[model samples]
Target: MTAPDPWAGILDPGETVLWQGRPDTRPQWAMLSPQRLTLGVVFIVAAALWGWQSAGLASAGGAMALLPWLAVPLLAVGLFNLAGHVLWDAFRRRCTWYTLTNRRAFIATDIPFRGKRLKSYPINRETILSFDESEPASIGFAFEPVPMKRSTRMKMVGFERIADGQTVFALMRGVQGKIERDFPIDPESLPR
Candidate 1:
């Protein structure tokens, strides 16, 4: 009796819909990962150390040797980490979207010159919720008992820099409440 849901196909057969929205198209690089910031810092430090060392070596090898063989690569690594990541983060924000259903939460992204990808996480009573109350808010999700290696681990998902963030987060909380009320764990089922 209403317009067809764009995300209806990805949902489960009996899943109830909660909320759906596209992330703002504004480019945002401030949300880039901590690892990216660390990488940039490491490169900058490397350039400083190598440049100082190469300067000392210049007296022995001459100015030509230092510039070509040493200083260039150091500068390149530093520039790549700083500028490259900002560009990547901006591109990702532009292509991201978010959806919430009673059964799960989903994020769909399509990077420029790269393909699209969709990831969904089932919502349960135990799923963690963290948020920022700034202008355009952010909600982040993380599941526990993770793998040791960060690269191999499941990264936390987020709805980034979107309007009405608090409203969306409240919807998530309501869905979680419904899950808990419908399927409360029984103490008798556990081994005593």
Candidate 2:
């Protein structure tokens, strides 16, 4: 007897899974670069000073008592910039899972309190692939617009920090090649 399909309802007809993986969950110390370290330290020191100064005013007035509490958020932001961001990223990565199929790539994240999210990007002939050759490499094949305070920015979506990125990158390239071969677009169909 054959084994049951793990992605029976998840996958489309004829679509086969090429690879599945999870990123490294350990704390990524690389996130705390020199720039971030200096900034975090400065912000933390400033917040502490501000809070200390504001504490003395608590005896003078009513609204002045709340001034010290205002530094709490700043301190939190400073902490986040220092090492909290790295820890948060690791936590998020721990909840993330990646799956690559013949037709598409899937990123599934199940963060606590935030909920589960499953996003897929189609791997078509027109898809542009980007490979980051780092120690634990990354393969980016799609872009998702991330909303910022002022505007939205495109963020690369892919298999991040996977051990076997080269293999996955090759598989993605092969998928694109096979798709082009199977479904050739006629040159006569021109928009220009």
Candidate 3:
């Protein structure tokens, strides 16, 4: 079965499907609101103006007249920021991932241009569903109480508002239920 799109509720569900950790499947444009880029552009423009005014050179006036040239850096910075934000969003979505197949639950992390770490818990071994809802959500899977044994924890930083955090949690619960039913393990009994 195919997975649902993460942003289906926000965008055109039919047209917008998640790439499932595939970089090529991510949105071409930034996932962040354009307002962020607009703010960056404004700041860059202001900085350029300040620099132009402070130079106090006759040639600076000619340079100021060329606003388009001055805007080049601002535009570049804005685009770069936008791209970075998009990449960040894509990375978060990819990292905050859970796959439930007939066999087991597959959890993984994707670091753009870098390597990824993936782990699978046989339907029986996966006993716990734990997460941190702090400013940055930290999702993980563990079978032991010791903190170090739990390698499923994914560090998801910079995501202010998760697209559908509740739904994701619900899905995780459902998966946990399935694991419990199929396996004779008590999730709570597992070490922290």
Candidate 4:
């Protein structure tokens, strides 16, 4: 008897599963650079000082008294910027699972409170595949633009920190090759 398909309705008909894995859950201390550390320290110190000064105004009535409470969120942000991000990153990696199929690459993350997310990036003939050849390498194929308050940053989405990177990369190349063979691009469509 054969095992039931884990991705029954998820994947399209005839889509073959190439690889499935999870990221290394080790603490990435290297993500906290000196600049980030300094910024975090500054934010923490400023928040603390503000909180202390505002505490004296606690005797005031109405919204004025609530000024002291504003520092709490700032302190939380500071803590997150400091070392919390490193721990959070590790935790997020632990919750994430990666799957590469003949058609697309999927990153499924299940975080508490935030719930589950399954994001897929297609691997077509035009898709640019890149490999970061490090210990427990990363294979990035797409750039997802993450929106911020003031600006947008491109986050590289891929199967990160996987032990078998080269093999997965080869499989992605095969997917692209198959796409090109199945649907060849017409030369007439080229822009002038």
Candidate 5:
């Protein structure tokens, strides 16, 4: 079999791993289908309008006369559709599974606009993992000691579509096992 990804190297630090999980992509994609469909509708409408104009429809000419009034809604719809596409791609590409290893943490993602960003964080400082059960399918991470606290949250980082929650959970547990095995720490013990 092929070797494990080099990105796993981040866990080599003296810290033990804690948790790792990715969102269910199937559900996420399903949730996004409406947006994709909306975009498709926009495309169809634009195409139909252009086609009617080309077909020498006098009514179409009259419709074009209302361009001033139509511009706002058309622009709004177009921008909304574009934003939806961007957001959908962003979630699919940029989100990732992460492991908090003994000495550090590792993140692998293919963000839409930003491209791929693979980062590892040392466990020396404080990092918090927050969950919203109301949206149980999602998870976020906050890295402290950073200048821009706003950017620290790992928003919408997981599979948008989840088929086997158990499998995902098991994988996370395994990562935790690796962290504990690789980095053992005794919180009660005194360093001095």
Candidate 6:
């Protein structure tokens, strides 16, 4: 039997569900994400090199024992990139969920130790759409800058890292077209 809808009363009275899925939660440590991997690799290598030097220094003399302490942060940072990012990404994926309705898109994430987060963005005519056609395709829309206490993170709320993204994109495009046709967008309220 199929599972019932998770969103019971959250949707509009007549809003029907078009699609729903989650990101692939598999471990992905490829070089595609160069920033984290590169940073992680660099620190890890530095830590290793420093550790070796420290070992050599320790063997040579007792006064050189302070150099190895410098590698501590390097080792920590390296481990953070190499293992930390992977674990974090996996945890995020595991906790995330996506739902696309006729009128809006919903993102629900129940992050471990962070409690629940629910966000809904309407699928209006003024909304811009973009997608990454890679494995576990992702669609981005409803772009907004989410400001935190320290910094801002770009939050393009949509279905991310889902399988068969092309099909979902096509479905959403068709549904969005119908919505636009049924309710023609006014020039004054075009989200300027």
How displaced is residue 176 in candidate 2, in Å? Answer: 1.2
Say which prediction, candidate 5 or candidate 6, comes out ahead on TM-score. 6
Tell me each candidate's TM-score: 0.63, 0.85, 0.34, 0.84, 0.42, 0.69
Clash count per candidate: 0, 0, 3, 0, 19, 0
Worst 10 residues of 1 by lDDT: 62-71
Once fitted onto the true fold, the runs of candidate 6 whose alpha carbons sit more than 4 angstroms away are 1-6, 31-74, 146-155, 185-192
Which parts of model 3 are misplaced by more than 4 Å? 1-24, 28-34, 50-77, 80-84, 87-104, 110-114, 119-177, 182-192
Off by over 4 Å in 4: 1-4, 59-67, 184-192
Q: Tell me, by lDDT, which candidate is best.
A: 4
Q: Compose the digit string of candidate 2's lDDT tens values, residues 1-192.
A: 999976889899999999999987888897788888888888899899999999999878889879998888889888998999999999999999999999999999999998999999999889999999996888999898999999999999888899999899999999999999998888889677
lDDT of 6 by residue, 125-146 (tens): 6778898999989898877899
On the 0 to 100 scale, the lDDT of residue 158 in model 6 is: 74
Mark the 10 consecutive residues where model 2 has the least summed lDDT: 183-192
Query: Which model scores highest in TM-score?
Result: 2
How high is the CA lDDT of each candidate model?
0.75, 0.91, 0.51, 0.92, 0.51, 0.83
Model 1 residue runs over 4 Å out of place are 1-9, 24-76, 143-154, 185-192
* Candidate 5's TM-score: 0.42
Q: Of models 2 and 4, which has the larger lDDT?
A: 4
Clashing residue pairs in candidate 2 are: none
Name model 2 segments beyond 4 Å from true: 1-6, 59-64, 185-192
